[model samples]
Target: MLSTKRAKSVEVRSKPGRIYTVLTTLGREIAQGIIPAGAVLPPECDLESRLGVGRGVIREAIKTLSGKGLVSVRPRHGTRVLPRRDWSLLDRDVLNWLVGQENPDRELLLAVQEVRSIIEPAAAALAATRATKTDLLRINAALTAMEASDSQATATAADKAFHLAILDATHNPVLQGFRGAIDTILSAVFVVAVDSVDGWFDGNLPNHATIARAIEERDATKARDAMEQVLGYTQTHLSKPKAGTRRRAGRTGAGRTLSQT
Candidate 1:
């Protein structure tokens, strides 16, 4: 695991890789909406000082940005940020790290969830119409692993694999685009919130079974609804305050255990 200090030092490397790192950091800032589109970048000298690199390194990083369609360089003029669509979002590495930046914005989080809500169900529906025998087997393999896992961490990884398998069944280029969004959002949410929730893994067996059965039956409607129901139930279960914890109890005059209340 890269510690925060080490991660921040991504620019300390040499030559080709160093320029790539600098471009990636600046690109990340642009994607996260810190460096607004069409905003003029600082002069090369200032950028070199701020980025703690040589002037040549700054020039190389800017050249990389231009290559990536992130910046416009003119004749004897300054560099300017380009539109977001021009940036290579299809670059998986960009999407992977961009979503896990220091703090993802609330709007970005909602964008990811909204994309999932739209795409995952559609993918499941398409999979119902077109999945191969091997696709079903792959998904079921993850299901079996999830069912057998006793540890919270292993169960969560199995859960991720199961969803990715569902996406793999779609066989449509467009529907297949949502896999990374799901992975990054869930990873970040698990780190920041879900991993700390009590009873998150305890009641999920039945939920998992229901989802697996729907997929096995190749029932699109059932699979879609079961996915939504599982997500909703898990959210509600995890949202409750745990018993004997210092969280302010409601007006019910009793502090009930989360699942018991």
Candidate 2:
């Protein structure tokens, strides 16, 4: 008689949050070019030992990375790192890892802002027409939180909330489809920019308030204009060198995961 044994799925089991640790460590190494493209990753057993995690955790991390286009795994060939161009750079975890790097890439951050400028203004215009009272209230509430925030981190969270609220107000699924990608870009852009510069969060409050007010008044043109102004400031801010640094002028360029309301 054939025995019926339930097969268990492999998961992270070495320690609490070991999977995250492995993912972050390896992700950063790849992002920073520590593990250069075309280099094969260390063997699974080696990573397990080095990271002090079990094989299950290591495999899971590698599987996740492979899905992000960071690595290619095959039976005969070992896991090899892929070129940065192949990576899903807009992936949330990958963006977060990039932000966590010792010196985040400025050029990448600029690219994010460019994408935002293209999408956000159009969404804000749609939001002015489509937003309900509840949407307006949410946008207002986010602005309120920004006003009340005592620290840069708190304010940045509220800032992200304000923008996300506007996007939600658009009520266009086609536009909303861009949300996930936008979220990743905004997070990496905001965190790196804010952490590097003091008072980075100060000037943006008025711009956000203007956007919310325009949407509240159902003025699509003004909403779009205000939104552009907000993003424009961000572009200018990112273009300038950080205070106290003479970084190259050519070089360019939030905080949470959210469920749809």
Candidate 3:
């Protein structure tokens, strides 16, 4: 249970925006399992007293959370935290809250990678056949930015842009519509995966360049294979090692280099 003092401590440290503060506080607590799923939130009056917020503010916060599938409310019963599977995991705020945790959920991270494996390779294959000059330019530019990036932040952004550009090159609205979801997932995963391994961004540069070059050459098969290789690096980095296993120096598992087919 979040005590009045603890809630107030969060409130004081929060930014000036009241509703956002309450929302983020509650959301973080939920994501961290501080407030576990299937638990009922305190009454609005209790929340108002605890967080020092108005009734209206609490209501609005709950409403927003409900929209994000974090909780469900009923007139007779109080708001109940829904199961993790119910969450709008792709929602920007929700994804940020989850990723921001001290130890992010491993399952969620793996799930994001699985989603990428299913989508990006096909998108790259399509881009190889359908990409216009402008689309190719954007993809190459993002790849160049990745190679030149001086910091992790820039590298992550450039990497995300490179993948999104391929989706755009597909010229399929359904695939294009995935941009927002893809951006959200990539933003979260890159922060975790890239930071976990030193030189990860630089190490993956060759694979990214291969993907771009394959697309430029209009080689759908090669583009798809290259994209799979890129995702293979992701799977290796994100996967939990067995108790007795160890990663080899200077290579991902299986002695695979980024540029290798």
Q: How do the predictions measure up, each by TM-score?
A: 0.66, 0.81, 0.79
Residue 117 miss distance in model 1 (angstroms): 0.6
The best candidate by lDDT is 3
Candidate 1, 98-131: lDDT as tens digits = 5675444445444555556666766766676678
Relative to the true structure, candidate 3 reaches a TM of 0.79
Error of 1 at 56 (Å): 7.5
Each model's Cα RMSD = 8.3, 7.2, 7.4
lDDT of 2 by residue, 1-261 (tens): 123222222232334378778988999898888999999999888998888888878888889999999999999899999998899876777776766454567787788778788889999989999999899889999989877665545655677788888889999887776766676666556545653444445556577788888888888899898888888877776776654642221112222221111
Q: TM-score: which is higher, 1 or 2?
A: 2
For model 3, residues 75-180, the per-residue Cα lDDT tens digits are 8988999998999887778877887564567678788778879989999999999999999999999988776665546666787889899999999998897787
In terms of TM-score, the best-performing candidate is 2
**Cα-based lDDT at residue 151, candidate 1:** 47
lDDT of 2 at 191: 47
| Steric collisions counted per model | 0, 1, 0
The all-Cα superposition gives candidate 2 an RMSD in Å to the true structure of: 7.2
Alpha carbon lDDT at 24, candidate 2: 85
Candidate lDDT scores, in order, read: 0.64, 0.74, 0.79
Ranking by TM-score: 2, 3, 1
Candidate 1: where is the Cα deviation over 4 Å?
1-16, 31-39, 45-77, 81-98, 150-153, 203-205, 231-261
